[model samples]
Target: MASQPLDPGNSGRNDPALLRLPSTVRHRIYLFLGVARWDGCPLLFDLDGPVSPSDQVTFYGLLLSCRAVYTEVSALLFSSNRFVIHYRNKRSLQPLRNLTPPSLAALTSLKVVLNQASCHHRREAEASGACCTRVSGCFTRKPKGAGGHCLIRRPHKNLHDTPLQSSDPSARLMLEEWRATAVYLSSNTKLDALELSLVCDVDQKEVEAAEHVVAPLLLFPKLKDCHVRLCISPNSHLRQLARNASRQASSNPALEPASPTSGSSRLLITLPREVRIRILEYTDLVAPLKEVMWNRLGLGYHYFSSGCSAWEGVPCLPPYHHGCQYRDCHGQGIIKDGIVRSDQLRSIGCFCGVRHAAFSSTCKCWAPPTPLFLICWDLCEDARFVFFSANRFVVSDSLVSANPWLAYDVSFTPDPKWLLENRSNYSWMEWYRQAQPPRAYPAHRFAATKFLREVVPADYLGYLRFLELVFPPYNHECWPHDGHPALQDWIDTVDWVKDKINAPAITLRLVMAGSRMWHPACPDDRGGLTRVQGIAVLTGYNRILKPLAVLREHGLTRFYADFAWPWKWTNRVYERLRAADDPNTILSWLEGQETLLNDRAERLILGEDQHDRLRSNEAKPGPSPWKMHSGREY
Candidate 1:
């Protein structure tokens, strides 16, 4: 069957009724025609294949109705759907490179999947002059080793027998093509999202080649979201690069004009208080405030090397016997025959632990509206309240370690000259070995109250309505001891929150490890468990939960605690406790079971509520309530 020609004569002239409709209605029709919407599915276009007959009629047919319609709707066709270009070989990317300037500029979302096998195939084809015979302009001239005919190709038992080389002409050509396409996309398009997937054999050279090919595409300036998947180990570097590009894109000044207050928008103050608050809600001010990890690299390095004792011959005299106030070194008795250390003993800086925080939401579709807070005093107050009260503020164990007073101790700064002169034989590692705390000591202690008291401002704390504290998994052995520092820390934290903060609802989460039952009867261990082990496990959990039960009287209207134990183990534990003979054990088991069931019910209810909210938002029409600075609608 033959396809109809685009822009057939007199088609639009005959359709007077369609031309009489409003421009907005016509645009809506064009959008529907260009990308038909099916529930819960994304619009995707594969440029690697030919256009389907249905698309030719419903999409291109509409465009060909008239020159005016084609001019108006062509851009929408590229912008509305996500185009997927699979680069299998050099010829695979021709469709993308052939896009006109107008089409490229309108492109907003793209996904590119790179395959390395095509390069190998091309190389093999070139070796035997198989591709040369297919070239239209090629002259039939036999070369030295041709035997008066194109060389016959031999099949390899293993396709990857010949490894791809960086200097190979086919590989170089493919990379050059990729770089050009990336440059064009970056320069011509203001993309909302870009996804790159590298599919290749898990070899070092192939991974390097894939990285070089995708390097330029990762720098799309106006992208709001960027996703990169490398089918190889050690992809963290590439992932970090993509993250940096996304951050730069969001912060790009060209994405939006100056603050709304810069112009006559100063008149916005005349709006009603309710209206102003509603407007501010649309901005990032209402987004959740998250505690982000700070000084990650420095802390990671220090943590991994904390036990290193490279600095030997370090001695403690008089007050220095207990070591420096910063606790960088612990004084060990002198050994006479050790070499003097050259490096100065320095304290880890104040920014070692978590010291910086930000208002960050999980949504990557839009950047936060930060300038709104700087507009005026009244607006700032409103924005702060909206931010604190409307969305939950999350605190974790890392935030608890951000005590600047403890971090910066000036009582003891090591004197380099004195240390070198009075050098001891003891190495720093030996001192660390002696000073290191017991393994039983908890690595992370629950300190939500301490974090709020030390880091958050009193004004912001009072405005908070919802607070979520994520604690590290409770250690049964460390937490059961009443005199332990970990136990004391937990008590002090909850006590302080009860005394000071007035958040209406508090959510406590403990991420736990999954447990497995070991069968004593079977030679090959399976799921069945002995009664004694089960009882011990349940008792340990009970002891861990006993202290947290105090949260019920913390004065909050609602308090929810989630012990994220696997359902299989939780049910097994409950059954084991139920079979026990003691009445006290039965009562405790009932209480724990009730809590678990209630948590499950609450989760289902919350999920349904979220679903309802989404449906309501969808029914309301217009753009999403969340304000997007990029001028793109979700």
Candidate 2:
């Protein structure tokens, strides 16, 4: 450690020892200096070209120290942080205009902030007492001699004097400003992320305006993440915009099939059509595409039957229930003057100690696929024919009229009527609100229904060859028994198919969701009994053949009652049965259950407990005979 220190030029050496280092070591130093220069420099650049002495010292001070440092650090600066482009006014763009192509090209991320109000408007607000309005906590008084506007938009008199303005600033004034900046920034093909923040009013139109400004950026080549944030101060509006923007941004697919001329085009297009078909055949969809529709939109399960624990809506008691004349109803139920409030009815627990899972007989009516199918046009069609045509789509009578989209053809285009109706409809608004973010499709201008209407092609719906209509339990007396509109949506769909294609081209499957074997032992008055009966009514082939016949009259070629239990529940039930029953008995029962719906369709609907009871000698002969009525005999 005590040896003499080596000297370069000072010791009469020809060249400096530092410069004599390896090229790799030199490059590393260049990188280090490039990053370190920031420590010496102020993070905030001074307005009007960084005139402050410290600002100059931070960037140029080190750069001027040597030519080599300048060359390396200059490029590093552009690639490191996002290039923030703030437009105070027309003349404020001078700094940007002077940026060289190389400097602009080095940038990676861009943030464009557009102030809703112009400098002139801001100045006028300052002059008028209205600008200082403290009534709603929106405006704050500027301290004397301090900066008058936001840190991002400081008071510069020359900024207001600039005469440049967009022709339609009132409507799309921000677009011109965006266009100018976009033209310059887009040249940098390396740009990955872009964020647009709009300082604007908190109103309905604000979202539309922000969307208009942000939509153009999504198509930017190499762009991965794009966000549009609102600038409303209270954050209510800002939060909503963020929720919607994130939802939309997350749904964007990373890769799409390329056109014929693109690089990926050869990879897919060169393959034979039969090979592509064969490839798709290997992929299987376990559940209907509707099961994962929420997943596609980046959300979780939202489907819940009415009056279920998961349903979201106001709850009220039956009209006949006198205000609980007695707090005597256990647990001091919502009672006023010893009478329970009808409104507190939903709080009542069932015999099972859980809330009613579905609408009860006497209670107030409770209101209740993988993305790979979309890979390419050809693949999608092939998969559709194989899956949709082969398997049955399950629908419910209760849901047909619940959603207007199901009842009628929906157009996704930004139609004026659809906007006005959806905006005003309370049900639509409530549903759309719950779907925000993680629960459903991130809230957007168009709800899931509207978005679907816009994106799904007309032809896509046409070729679906098989469909199943499943009705929910119909035994709830208190539930709103809205007359099944004779104007069934499926009938309309069938009619449309008849006009487009040959008769009997489509197969319609009608199904009840549960087995009827348990219904006889179940008490009719119990809510559980009603739930089983709902599916029991659809178990027999004769029960559904009438509706199927009507649908066939319209256009369907084949009609069948599919009494299959939901597979998800089936797997769970089977696991429990396997643990208790002999393996051979369970296997035989399973084989019989598998074909219960498909084997002649008129067999008794057997419940999981029926077989178990029969094997265990717990079975009792039922009054209701398992009589098979033959349709052929009729």
Residue 90 shift from truth in candidate 1, angstroms: 10
- Cα lDDT tens digits for candidate 2, 1-634: 6744443333435434444555456556755644433333212221234333434433456556655545556566655543444555442445555655666666544444444222112221222112111211111222221123331223333322112223335436445556565566566545444322223222333555545554555444544444343432223344344434443443334322222344443465467877755654544432312211111222122121111111123222333123222111112223334343443321121100011111111122111123345456665566665554443333333221221112111122344665678775634324432331221111222122221233334455555455445433232221121222232333344344444433356544444433332221111212233435434433332333332333334444344444433231234445656585566676556546645644344222222343344336633221110011100100
Compute the lDDT of residue 314 as modeled in candidate 1: 55
Cα lDDT computed for each candidate against the true fold? 0.41, 0.35
| TM-score, per-candidate, Cα-based | 0.36, 0.32
The segments of candidate 2 whose C-alpha lies over 4 angstroms from its true place after superposition are 1-23, 26-67, 76-101, 105-482, 486-501, 507-546, 551-595, 598-634
In angstroms, the error of model 1 at 115 is 16
Which candidate number maximizes TM-score? 1
Off by over 4 Å in 1: 1-261, 268-275, 287-377, 393-442, 447-451, 470-480, 503-557, 560-592, 596-634
